[model samples]
Target: MKENIALFLAILYLIYRYKTYKNVNKIIEDRIENVHRSFFKRIQDVLQCSKEDAEKVGLALDKYFVPLKSKFYKIDNNTYSFVDEGGFKGSFSIDQNYNLLTLEYNGVDLLALH
Candidate 1:
């Protein structure tokens, strides 16, 4: 029916808009990461801790603690959940090939695409 077709079209349009927005958001995030990397990846840095340590800490905070602290986010093409309300705590992580930044909520791996 025409009504169904119109609804489908609307859904497709919404999807298009969402994808575009996500792409822009990702670009912004990448730029921010690049800025950090540029500073830390330098060979002759004067910082107390090495760039590797900083990267590790960043990974730990993001992969392990982020889900517990943040509301929700997607990383590496997968979505994750993190919610805490007193005793009712929730968390999740997604990882494949490596667990470098994978987060877990309770006992469930919410980040797995499979």
Candidate 2:
């Protein structure tokens, strides 16, 4: 009788762990679907392209963003850098925490906000 009670408790614990894992997996999957869906949806709306054309659009963006991201840097002095792009002048800052980096543009910085 004692062995039977112990085995029942073990099975219950295993079931609880399995359910928790399944819920986490489901949340991750939902987030992925949102990202992919919105990405293709925006492309289709902007370029008037069909869903079938997304591969080419994604390919072009992949090519463009590689070099575009290189120009940004973090200065140790912790002051914003200002730029004058003729029609636009700007100042910008980067605040980092863990794996996330957020860029904030001061009015003087002609940073591209996208």
Q: Pick the candidate with the highest lDDT.
A: 1
Q: lDDT (CA) for every model shown?
A: 0.49, 0.44
lDDT (Cα, 0-100) at 54 in candidate 1: 42
C-alpha RMSD of each candidate structure in angstroms: 12.5, 13.1
**TM-score for each prediction?**
0.31, 0.34
TM-score of 2: 0.34
Off by over 4 Å in 1: 36-114
Error of 2 at 61 (Å): 12
The residue pairs found clashing in candidate 1 are 91-105, 93-103
Error of 2 at 92 (Å): 22
Model 1 agreement with the true structure over 1-114: per-residue lDDT tens digits: 999999999999999999999999999889757654643333113223456764553354344444222333333243333454443344333334223344455665534532
